[model samples]
Target: MIRRFITRQLRQPLPPARPESDPYARALPKGDLSGGRPAVVRVDGATKQALETGRTRLLVAAVSFTLAFTLIGWRLVDLGLMADQHEPSLARSLSSDALETGRADIVDRNGIVLATTMPTASLYANTQHIRNPQRAAERLAEALPDLSPAHLRAKLASGRSFVWLQRNLTPRQQDRVNRLGIPGLYFQREQRRFYPHGALLPHVVGFTDVDNQGLAGIEQSFDDVLRASAKPLQLSIDLRVQHVLAQELAGAMTEFRAIGAAGVVMDARSGEVLAMVSLPTYDPEKPAAAPADARFNRASLGIYEMGSVFKLFTTAMALDEGIVDLNDGYDVRQPIRVARFTIRDYHPKNRWLSIPEILMYSSNIGTVHMAMDAGTPRQKEFLGRLGLLQPAGVELSEVGQPLVPSPWREINTMTISYGHGLAVSPLQLTSAVAAMINGGTEARATLLKQDPAGAGKGRRVVAAATSEKMRRLMRLVVVKGTGRKANTAGYVVGGKTGTADKPSGGGYARNSRIASFVGAFPMDDPRYVVFAMVDEPKPTKETFGYATGGWVAAPIAGRLIERIGPLLGVAPRGDDNELIEQMLVDIETNAEGRQLASN
Candidate 1:
């Protein structure tokens, strides 16, 4: 009908038979053509008007077709050639979604992938266009067993323009949904934050939510950095060292039947945390399913009174301030009475003790006297400079605050001198200890990789001579003191043992203790500061019914140092007596010290 209408519209109505009476018609002589010339006839006004209308309609139709084709071609070019290829969803979801960057990958200093983004298909729907809602829901449920058909059907039936059917669908599941050919069911290409190392790097790399927002650890701390930058966040962590630390810490935790365990391996020179382990850790992929206790980061977030380790600070301060020398003696013949409390050493010498002997025996009373000589004001100032009087500035959101006594009285100073009144995170202690042994340079622990040239010299926290004396004392401890079990051959390990009773209820738990050891290798020139702590460790047969730091935690450090030293290319210098003699103090040596030196 339309074709006939167009044909009629284009055809001028036949000029009324003008043959009989019109002069023009008579002139034309009934369409007769002579002399090879056709008869000419004048067109009527209505016919001319109809012809003009037909021509105008044809031109309009042609223009419309050209414009339509031009638009289609431009769209094709825009999508195929001019579109942002980097933005995978730009062209498809332009109107409904805003531009977003893919979350940057997190890698270790060695370029090992700790956390990354993986492409996945997420199912969504335009409920308004969904037909046969119940049927579609049933088919989707069959494809994705985890999703309920009833819930899906209710969502599809709801008179809404958009709704999420499911997120992070596996390829097989996505394929199954596609085969259903359900209207309004679509797949949105999305990136899911994936932890390739799973629980191993969970606390550091952290986990993300469905929308790829960082929630904990370094991820949470550097969330804005991760989102804005496309480059991978390189951490100071060494995957190899992390594995070693975690393995040894887990073994220690199990052997001692402890509640938990934490460990750290930091470069004393650069303050780079090569390895940090907190056991009972959760998998980043299934963070929600993990218990709250499992998510607790003990290494940096759990603050405790770190027993005799504070002696390292106390001794360093006394020496740095010229208040005490290696030969300086402190009378610890009896427990020092301070108010209602008394400072007593677990292994009391019951005699005047030199600074070296004080540290070698880990005498609590001796440390208090040393702090007294340094004076309370000087002790506080010294600890503050060592980064021990505050929270550690580590690059993590779960950092804990150090608990220092308010109105710090003489008793508080005495107790803090032995690590009772002052509570600090393992990180703080480790960093401070690192500085004490690393030529007195202030060590600031960090998670980000450091530039070799730009490690930026740390401010001198203690005198180089004091640091050297501390190193000698630490070496004496490992050689002939409580840390004898930590004497790994050829490593020249130097360290301190801490066995602090866990504060419980009101006072402190008798049996429960945080046994810890902080050590550095190559004592002549310290490198890494390795620390290990076991929470609430119980006595084991291997430990000879002792759960002190020397028994429970020192061996862990020794083993870790022994293993990681070779891996880190630190060749063992077998019995470098010359180096040992250079830093040796003029103290009376027993038969044990002679035997250890000979060996």
Candidate 2:
């Protein structure tokens, strides 16, 4: 019936064919109407215009869609084929710009890497996007075994938008997490501070916190400079010298059964610290795991009474002030009783001693007499000038302040003259000794590498003649006195021995002692100052059951100089006793005349 209806409608569709003269009929194509086919039907102008507009819009839409799809396809091909070449360049660009956002590196004077920063991946999550929190946590825990499953589940179920899963993940760990295909898990790029030498330079280089903030040593001292600059911070430390000093110090500490040790190697002429070590040390990369005592910097931060080393200052002060001469003699046979204190010699000579003999024997009675003659005010002034009354100004935040007597009485003066009643860090003693031997010029101690051409003319703490006399006396000590163990052959080693009892319970401890030696080689032209100290060293069979500086610390200094002299380019010369004798002719002649007169 439907087919018959369509046939009837088609038979009636031949309403009227327009003539060729009509504009609308001209628009239609010419065709024959026959065999039940519908004849042409004419429509109004508005309907024809609407149909033309619709066709134009459809054509424009097709072209736009085609162009968009073509561009997208080209992009996919470029990414897939050129990924190997493009990825490395992209990584280089990111690494090159890392210093702007990350911390700068730290290196030794030779440009050896000490501390640096590297890129790492940190895992985080958008907890809201995680479905089935328990299952997601279990999967994540498997990928990162260090993370707790319960912790992860709590974080994922907290209904929070974001949470940190782990920080500083390794490449393998990151790959494992990615393979888990967790929906909410993500990775953030971050930078971490690394120490290549690890425990070797914990005290000097220091360590940083998780946020890359410096907390100790040079790291704490120069934190702002490290964060703001792109260039590596170079120190005056020579890695070779550092190793030798630390090795020698550690050996001595172990052999003597010391509780701790500290050592420093410094260029006497320039005042640049070549090496500074304090033990026991810690690993900079894992400072939190180390004990507090391991992190203490004894060289610069720990203060103690440095015993007979203080005599160097007292003798230098007397000579510089014209209060005493090399031939000056003092009777050191009797002990000096000042108020409630008694000053006596460790090794006594029951006769008069010349100035040189007093220092050689380390006579505390003679030193007290010298201080009494110089007066308390002059001794105070002299020490203050030597940079001992104040804290050391080296490039370290862990520096110690000297403990000086408040009233500055005569008893204080006498005890301080023999290295008691005043406590100073080893750095202060080393720096002051450097000045005394370096032609009397006070070179401020520093840790940064310095240009020799730009070095300042240092302040004169003593006259050049006084410094020469002090050197001669130090040499005399090494040749015939307490520092004999420190006299290495051909180097003309000159030094002072110091053994101070550690203060305890309002007095000196009988068993605990600080044994130390400070020495300079080729006394004629001193270049470097080497200082070694052992804290609370116990008596050993090899040391004759005594833990004095001459027995324990002097041998360390002697061995260290022999090893480092070649490395530092200090030439060995034949024994210069004849020359030293000629320089000391006046003192020898005076002593002979006194002996002849007494005989």
**Best candidate according to lDDT:** 2
Q: Write candidate 1's Cα lDDT for 1-599 as tens digits.
A: 44565566547543445544554442445545454434445455655676688888999999999999999999999889976774766544742332263577889989998988777999999988887899988888988999998999999999788888888887898899899898898888987888878788677777888888889998899889888776799999999999999999999888989999999999999999999888899889889999998899888998989998888888888888888777677777798776677667787767667778888889988888888877889988999999988888988988999888889888888889888988998999899999899888888999999987655289989888888888888988888888888888998999999999988897899998999999998898798899999999999787789999999999999999989999887889876555346335455553245447658
Error of 2 at 586 (Å): 6.4
Instruction: Estimate every model's Cα lDDT from 0 to 1.
Output: 0.84, 0.87
Best by TM-score: 2
Residue 189 lDDT (model 1): 91
lDDT (Cα, tens digit) per residue for candidate 2, span 306-403: 99989999999999999998778798889988678777888787778888888888999999889999999899999999999999999999999999
Error of 1 at 367 (Å): 1.0
Off by over 4 Å in 2: 1-96, 129-153, 179-182, 582-599
TM-score of each: 0.79, 0.82
- In candidate 2, position 45 carries an lDDT of 69
lDDT of 2: 0.87
